[model samples]
Target chain A: MDLSPIWLTLKLAAITTSLLFIVGLPIAWWLSKGRSFFKTIVEAIITMPLVLPPSVLGFYLLLAFSPQHGLGKLLQDTFDTQFVFSFKGLVLASFIYSMPFMTGPIKSALQQLPVSLTQASYALGKTQWQTFKSVLVPNIKPSLLTAIVLTFAHTLGEFGVVLMIGGNIPGVTRVASIAVYDSVERMDYAAANTYSLILFSITFVMVISVFVFNKYQAKSPLE
Target chain B: MIDLSIEKRLKAYRGQQILKISHQFTTGSITKIYGPSGAGKTTLLKTIAGLVYPEKGKIVVDSQTWLDTDNNINLPPQKRMPGFVFQDYALFPNMSVLAHLQYATNDMEWIKRLLLLGKLDTLTDHKPIHLSGGQQQRLAVLRALAIKPKLILMDEPFSALDPDMKTELIAELKLLFKELAATVLIVSHNPQELEGLTDGDLYIP
Candidate 1:
């Protein structure tokens, strides 16, 4: 069994999750707290990936990453790095696909928190960043955990977008989901079953551990 | 002296009305704000704290203009840093009793003294979930005092305490407020409860 696909999938999930956290936290915070007129439009755009078909999103990404025009042309001319059919391309696609999974929970978590907590922090002379870091983030641990797990798991199982943009290049973009598809197409049921079992077990353990940890935290006096 | 003249349009189920207030509060004095429900008492406190903005207003604190609509200047809450005790006792659930005070100041002696004042010394490590209603209220008061703010605004701060506890805490707080030379505005539906402690009164209709 070539475990390279598993390693690539893990790497993709890891990088995508980290990038999502960096990019998604500010978006989630703004969506949760801001009352601007443009909020609805931005929210609708971010949530598009959740409802749109993966192939639709992938097609647009493919066009955007094409070296002939727009962002792809700029990247090719300046950075000289091709985004399509590469690990970087796969990462970008996975991030788009998994954005809602990361941002939704975080936004709801921030909204559900008592407004008075932030007010209190401000009254105590703490800045907005201080209040967010010391008060809001600590209290919303459960939601943060849920967002991370869901984004990681969702990215791990992604297929259509990865298939369209990644093109199944082994050792570079051949993630576990693509590997399983390849095995089945070749009538290699044993290899497909092996990949499927490994994916299922890993996801199940991750989800179960999160639940167990949450329950334990709930039982603790501090929570 | 703290001077404020403000107008805010408030919409309630009854109708829309203008909350127009103009007043001067002396430094180091305790003033009671008495009003019926929905008369904008809490809103007034929030406005002074810079948590809410008024349609038209000027708030001058100690010769400093905190808010000046004509000048288009409105300081943020952090810049104002007024100590406020909410009616609901907005203690952070994730933070322990001691952590709440420590977050506002680095003075260990002040923190210890505040814990003693609030009678929360023994429960320093306890979170808000573990504390009783009165204990939580006391913690809120202590947290507000942690900054030794020049102005303190309290909304129904003693509603959760028993009569005896309220009396005792108010006595201690009166001395502490004087020591800090902090102007205090306390909102209450029952003004008699604060008769002796309040030096002046403002009625909102």
Candidate 2:
């Protein structure tokens, strides 16, 4: 069996998860703490991908990533990088598709935390960033772990959006899900089963570990 | 000295009322803030600490203008850096007793002394969940004092402690407050608890 698709899928998941963490931390923190009128609108927009049909999001992203469009044209002109049918395009599409998976748990975790914890840190002369890093992050470790695992697994299994945006370009964008689809289309049941088994095993382990870790955290005195 | 004249519109079940207060507290003094429930006692302390904003007010702390609504110069809480002990003892669940104090200050000797003052030296490695109510309250107070802040605001700081523990802790705190020359404002429902420790009183109606 060709392992290129598996390697590509892993690379995409790793990159997307890392990017989501860097970008999602502040967004989740704001959604948890901010009281602005625009917060509702922003939250709705972020969560839209979760409810919308994957085909619909993929279709729109395809247009937005077209070189003729505003965002796509701006990137093309500024950096001379074509987003359509490229690895970069797939990364951007996956990031959007998996955003809520990344941010929802984090935001809820932060909201569930007592406001006094952050306030106490502030009163102790710690800056907002310092408090977030030292106090808020450590306390919400379980939720953060949940967020990371969910986003990675969700991105790894994405099908419709990856199809529309990434167009099955062999090593470039032919990730595991797309590889499974290709195998089935070619009537290669053995190849399809091989890919499916691996995906299922990995995801099962990740989800089970998350639950075990959560149970351990619950039993621990500190958490 | 800390001087403040503030007015905040508070929404109550009955209706809306303005909490208007003007006062000055001398340096190295302990003031007890006594008031009925819904009288804005906690709000007053929060405003001083820059946690809550007063609609109209000027707060001067140690000759420095911390808040001036007229001038639009309100400092944030980190800059104010006044030690605040929440009514619920907002100890971090992930941090041990020693970690809580260490988060506020890097001075090892100060942390050691603070642990002794709170009688938590033995439980330095314990988290708040493992601590009893009185131990948690004492940890909160010790964490606040760890910063050696010039101004300290405590809301119901002794509600959980037993009488013997309260008496012992208060006596030691009185000496510690003097040594640091800190101004303290304590809000308590039972005014009798702080009768001997407090040098001044502010009744909020």
Best by DockQ: 2
Candidate 2: where is the Cα deviation over 4 Å? A67-80, A217-223
Clashing pairs in 2: none
CAPRI-wise, candidate 2 is high
| lDDT of all predictions | 0.92, 0.92
C-alpha DockQ for predicted model 2: 0.88
Q: Candidate 1, clashing residue pairs? A: none
Q: Identify the leading candidate in terms of TM-score.
A: 1
Task: Write model 2 residue lDDT over A114-213, tens digit each, in one string.
Answer: 9889989989999999999999999998988899999999998999998998899999999999999999999999999999888999888988888887
Residue A5 of model 2, lDDT score: 88
TM-score of each: 0.96, 0.94
Residue-wise C-alpha lDDT for candidate 1, range B1-205, written one tens digit per residue: 9999999988766889888999999998899998878889999999999998999999999999999999999999999999999988888888999899989999999999999998999999999999999999999999999999999999999999999999999999999999999999999988778978999999888
Q: What fraction of native interface contacts does model 1 preserve? A: 0.88
| TM-scores of chain A across candidates | 0.95, 0.94
What is candidate 2's lDDT per residue for B77-156, written digit by digit as tens? Answer: 99999889999888999999999998999999999999999999999999999999999999999999999999999999
